[model samples]
Target: MPFMEFVNFYLMPGIVLGSIYALGAVGITLVFGILRFAHLAHGDLATLGAFAALGVVTIFGVSPWVALPVAMVACAFMAIGIDKLFYDYLSERPKIIVVMSSLGIALMLRAVVQVVWGVDTETYTRGIVRPDDYWGIRIRDREIYTIIAMFLIVGVLWAFLQKTKWGKAMRAMSDNPDLALLSGVDNRKITMLTWGIVGVLCAASGFFLGINTELKPLMGWTMLLPMFAAAILGGVGRVEGAVIGGLIVGIAEETSVLFIPGEYKAAMAFAILLLILLVRPTGLLKGKVL
Candidate 1:
């Protein structure tokens, strides 16, 4: 293969993977920003969303594209339920403790998924979309669809955060929860809304990922590190950071294959994360401290 072709193939996978990571990371950052916890269950919540989509596809015999929204709605409901059951009462707890608690929730959720779905790998779409050429580059329909969906969701989310009343309320809560409360912002409602939005985003990301790659019960767990790295790199609580960080991480992972073995691809995000922590712990975008 020519150098350009080789480069394109390497770059494309990274972008697709990074987009998925970015979508998940955005949810993580949002949860962290609004709820003030790490929300470790994010990955599993995403997995749950994927499984929901899988179920939807199975029941309706619908196209993956058609099934996505239904899956996202399931994820949204699950997220709301998780918050209501696990974190709602504990919202006032210490932040670090909440993070650990989130881990516990994550573990329980993972176990529940394993019990419900078993450990077998699953696929959402039976018929694969072959790669098509785009200006001398090759890409799959799933890849194009994922990228388009990501941008659409991100754009809508950005607008919601900036232009809408609820969006402003979310920002206020993220900036200062106590102040928001004093200002008459219902923290409970905001909390539920945040979970809902994050849930939708997580489900969409997981669905795309599962549709592209086979869905294993632990599929979301494997994405945690890269998603975290992307969040931290972009600056926690900053929506743009999550998106850009995901792109950077995705591109870096793909480009690294030029000099490193593919087996090491999983480690690239961690390595970059470590370096960032050492150099600029606040993240590249300088997000406000929680």
Candidate 2:
């Protein structure tokens, strides 16, 4: 393929993949910064959100856009419930305990999805979607939607953190939980708020991933490595850093095929993770150290 063709095909898709990863990473970062846990179940929650959307779309015969909100709300509630059931009691314990709980949650969630949706691969819509060309470059509608959604979602979140009272409360809690609590920041309320945002982000990520490809029980699980890589790369507590890290990881994964075998493509995130931890443990944006 020609240079621009290569760029158009590889780089553009990378951005879309990055956007999905960023969405999931932002959620991971939020939970980490606020609750101080690794949240291994984050990707599985995304999978639940996607399958929720699929169910809504199938049952109601509604557009995917319409089902987005439904799935987000559903997942948000599920996240809150999960916190109450599992993480709440362990809150006072070592955060590692919660991390192990999250892995269990991940397995439970994947099993739930498999039980409900079956193990078969499913698509949001039938028929092939041809890409639309612009200035000799082609892009799919879903890919465009993914990019736009990521920016809008994360941009509004940043603005919220900068402008809103609850946003400040959340940030204060992240910066210093004991101090924030002493200063009248309601820990319960802030914890719930973080989970809500994380839930919505997971839904968006899973929805986009499903739209871009096909949905299976393990899809979100497969995405966990890159999503965590993005979160770590961007800096654990910095949201914007997640976006940049996600893009870098996404682009690297795509472009690496030029130099390495495609079968090992998923290993790209693993390599990036190790390199960053070895050199700059904080991340590209000087985020919180793990």
Give the clash count for each candidate.
0, 1
List per-prediction Cα lDDT, in the order shown.
Answer: 0.86, 0.93
Q: Any idea what lDDT model 1 has?
A: 0.86
How would you encode candidate 2's per-residue C-alpha lDDT over 128-234 as one tens digit per residue?
Answer: 99999888879988888899999999999999998999999999988888999999999999898899899999999999999999999999999999999999999
Question: Candidate 1 residues 210-232, lDDT tens each?
Answer: 97798888888888888989988
Question: What's the lDDT for residue 227 in model 1?
Answer: 90
Deviation (Å) of 6 in candidate 1:
4.1
Model 1 misses residue 233 by how many Å? 0.2
Q: TM-score for every candidate vs. truth?
A: 0.95, 0.99
Off by over 4 Å in 2: none
Any residue pairs clashing in model 2, and if so which? 234-241
lDDT of 2 at 270: 95
Best by lDDT: 2
| Alpha carbon lDDT at 42, candidate 2 | 95
Cα deviation at 46, candidate 2, in Å, is 0.4
